[model samples]
Target: MKLYEFERAPNPRRVRFFIAEKGIDLASIERIQIDIGGGENRAAEFRQMNPMGTVPVLELDDGTALSETMAICRYFEGNHPEPALLGQSVIEQATIEMWNRRMEFNLLLPVAMAFRHTTGHFSDRENVFPDYGSDCGQSAQRMFDFLNDHLADNDYIAGRQFSVADITAVVSIDFARVIKMRLDPDKHARLIDWHERISARPAASV
Candidate 1:
């Protein structure tokens, strides 16, 4: 397997962390750089693999490419089920997916909008200029409060066991900090504790 990775990007870091948590010795996996600023991922050759021209694309052994960080992480879990990052039972799977979707929609998407509009990071690809910065920031903060409340009695997002939902939440929350947004530590003690625990995981640095 080959992973098209970018060192500084949080999207790719999510996938890298999943790979590490799974204990998949992909040391032999090839890594292709997709420099976002240099337009490397936008090249014609790379675009053929994924029309979106994104990083963290996983090219399987048979040469099939998987795009999207969550999709790639789920695929890895499916292929290597020992670690079981998604879930084992049907109900568990559904619940995990539910939280994962909520995290993406409520937190991750807003952070992306905030960063793109406020920082104009991808202005070249699409016009962005603080068009929705305020709304995005508000949405992120709202989601943070929601998640903080939800996680008050749980060790992880979905339940006591760790799952993909936690991965999504952690990445989204960390990414949202770019907009100076976060769950209030004073009001969200459990959420803050969860973040600290996840951050201390060795795979977190992967």
Candidate 2:
């Protein structure tokens, strides 16, 4: 399989993190970098592969192309279940899914929206609303407060074991830097600790 991705994009980074955590062979899957900022993804040849015109599309050898970060990660997780990032059991899977979704909606989406709207990064292709972006920044702050408190008692997002939820949380928090939203050292002590711990992992660098 070959992955069409933007090197610095958060969505693609999540996939890279998942692959690294699973101990997947990097050489086995070819990585093709797409220049998203340059509008390479909007090109006709690329759009034919994925009409959505998004990066991080996994093109299988059989000519099947899979979009969406989680779907691609789920594919590999099914193929390599050794170090289960999603989970090992049904309940664990559900819990991880719950936490991952929470991070996706509450943290990731807000940060991304804030970045896109406030920075006018895609003004050429879409509308930019400063007020909406500010609201999203505030929304991300609220989620940060929730996660900081959640991490106080729980060792991980879903509990003790590290899972995809943690990956999502870490990536979202890191991405928030672009929006000037960050965890306060005093107010978000637990989250800061968690961030440091997770960042030390080898997979986090991916």
Top TM-score prediction, candidate number: 2
Query: In terms of lDDT, which candidate is strongest?
Result: 2
Off by over 4 Å in 2: none
The deviation in Å at residue 35 for candidate 1 is 0.4
TM-score on alpha carbons, each prediction: 0.93, 0.97
| Residue-by-residue lDDT tens digits, candidate 1, 50-139 | 999988899988989999998898898888897888888999888888877887788788888898898888878888869687788888
Tens-digit lDDT track of model 2 for 14-36: 99999999998676889999988
Backbone clash total, candidate 2: 0
List clashing residue pairs in candidate 1: none
User: Candidate 2, 151: how far from true, in Å?
Assistant: 0.8
Give candidate 1 regions above 4 Å deviation.
none
Clashing pairs in 2: none
User: Model 2, residue 178: what's the lDDT?
Assistant: 74
